[model samples]
Target: MAAEQTSSVVLVAVDDTVLAQLVQAATTDALADEVTPPLTAGRAWTADRVAWLREFHRVRRAGLAGPTGEATWAVVVDELIVGSVRLKHTDEHGVLDMGIWLTRGARGRGVGRTATAAALRQAASLGASGVRADTTVTNTGAMAVLRRLGFHLTLSDDGQDVRALLLLDPEGTAACEVTSEPS
Candidate 1:
């Protein structure tokens, strides 16, 4: 997949050179608190950053062709890197999982929504039948963005996380429905 541009943000496919910058971005307080659980365990100092990048590379090369069946991208706005988003293939055929994180400065500005919309389009082009995502229940911002993008709440687990799904039609008329189920 190639980089995609939105009205307010750009999704640049992750590459080896951007790994270091992404590691640094992940260390930011907002990102650590909102998205990356592993990084929240401790401050992502130099060594920790290096280790994270190393593992990220070892597990999956930085591109659409990565071994992990995931496509990760660096989210940029105004030429500054703000966060990252990922789309991963699931065990269920034609289904993909989407994840995203934005820095403190980028939150509540429609960056995530725009970037995600672009990603969903990319996924549809890649033949995805549906896309799903999970967000912490407390993360109202994320939930709102997903809802606005046509993702319907499908499940709520332990009052901690909520799962949402958006079914895509090849003809481009996707329908979203919201449901609530105990995890």
Candidate 2:
């Protein structure tokens, strides 16, 4: 028996609409520790639905926005937001960071690959200099997906966590395309 999957997964721009909430809800609900930020440990926080809602549109509408780019949407089967991904801009040199999550029931259905490809497409279209991602070493699923997307492991502190890096270049021979073509 296979797991039930979301009917569809489409990446759209995040807007001040119901669609934004749908994305946020799915991401939050999928979190193993709503109180702990995925990137870091021991950080106390709560899922601020309203805050995320406001910021999602405010930043998404920026003039620099791109299709499937920063501050966007990934619709999975109508309104059932099976997966969500984002690229947060920061002041640090390599500030473009990505976070993604898929509904528990939506796993093993390619939602992760779909959402990641959408984000990469957006990044490539936006002329991004580079893109970076970090995942726990134990997160084999994430590592596998990243590898499929051409993300190479850049740093690995012992065996606990690994930092994978992917360049979003529009010219280079890097294959940004993600499909289930048997490898």
Candidate 3:
């Protein structure tokens, strides 16, 4: 399935073909610290890490209804792969956990906001009732996007992590629009 571009950002379903492109972006445009754990020494993208990244997406390539009940997409802009977005079924019924990561060049642009909204809509289409995300306080951009999308955010006592939750409307209209800014 193709995601209609919003602000020049389009989400392409991650298949074997797209996976290679996604991996390239992860290795080149993104820091290993950003996308995957530091399995290798000192944030270097090693052969082991590269192999791990490939397998990570391979299991969930089935899209939403796959056995994993997870869907992942490559975030593309101007016909180039810039990032990735995904939705995974959480332990809670009707709720999904969403995550997104962008290459360094893609940050600060509105790409994240557009891709996130698209992912939420995809969740709604899968009959999900709610979506949640977890990010560090340092990730202000992601926090801002969630707030603009009408999510309720809660901060950890230590103030290092923040969690967001958005309960979609029955018709999923909540995913259709974003407020100018958080009130």
Candidate 4:
């Protein structure tokens, strides 16, 4: 259960300093535990952390990418950023990939869902026909949110890992001519 805190939230872009700080803080915390061993998969947190910081800068610099293009937004609650979402169109593939993150204190409190929904709406507004996202099978929390967002599961393997895809296009034209479910 999440903390019983009441907050009126707003969605803003990544250019805002406060939102950037919040994203960095949340991302650092998320990498803290998974920074080490078995989950590391022979990787280094120092490097990954640096990469994340760079990404933070880029996301911040993205500012307003307009309605039909990639955009980053932060979920602000009570004037504080608790989460963020990134939605962009992969022109090569003609599909939009949506990404989201929520602070530790904000998790399990519906922040992710709210932010993701906002991102979805933005994607639709961007002239995108559909939106899609993926997460490791172990990410049950994210999976739950994605499922509720009407994502269709296309594939899964026995490694307790899975990949999920969603379609946000009502007319099914923005993504592709495939008006059916993903394989």
Best by lDDT: 3
Model 2 scores a TM of 0.68
The lDDT of model 1 is: 0.71
Writing each residue's lDDT as its tens digit, candidate 1 over 74-154 gives 888777778877788888888899888888887777777777876787777777899999888788888888888788985
Models 1 onward score TM values of 0.78, 0.68, 0.89, 0.67
- Local distance difference test, each candidate: 0.71, 0.61, 0.85, 0.61
Model 3, C-alpha of 12: deviation from truth (Å): 1.0
- Report the poorest 10 consecutive residues by lDDT, candidate 4: 174-183
Q: How well does model 3 score by local distance difference test?
A: 0.85
What lDDT does candidate 2 reach at residue 39?
Answer: 38
Q: Write the per-residue lDDT of candidate 3 for residues 1-183, one digit (tens) a residue.
A: 996544467789778889899999999989888888889789888899889878888988877678888878899988899989889989998989999999998888777887888888888888889999999999888898889888899999999999999999998778557422222
lDDT of 2 by residue, 1-183 (tens): 997543445676555564566545654555534312343343323355435545554666553444433564554645565655677554444336677766677667666776777777666665665667888877788888888888888556577888877776655335566643322
Model 3 spans > 4 angstroms off = 1-7, 178-183
Per-residue alpha-carbon lDDT of candidate 4 for residues 73-176, written as tens digits (9 for 90 to 100):
76786777776677766753546787776767777766666666666666666666677786777788888877776777655566665555666556543322
Candidate 1 residue-wise lDDT at 52: 62
**Better model by lDDT: candidate 1 vs candidate 2:** 1
Per-candidate clash tally? 0, 2, 0, 3
Better of 1 and 2 by TM-score: 1
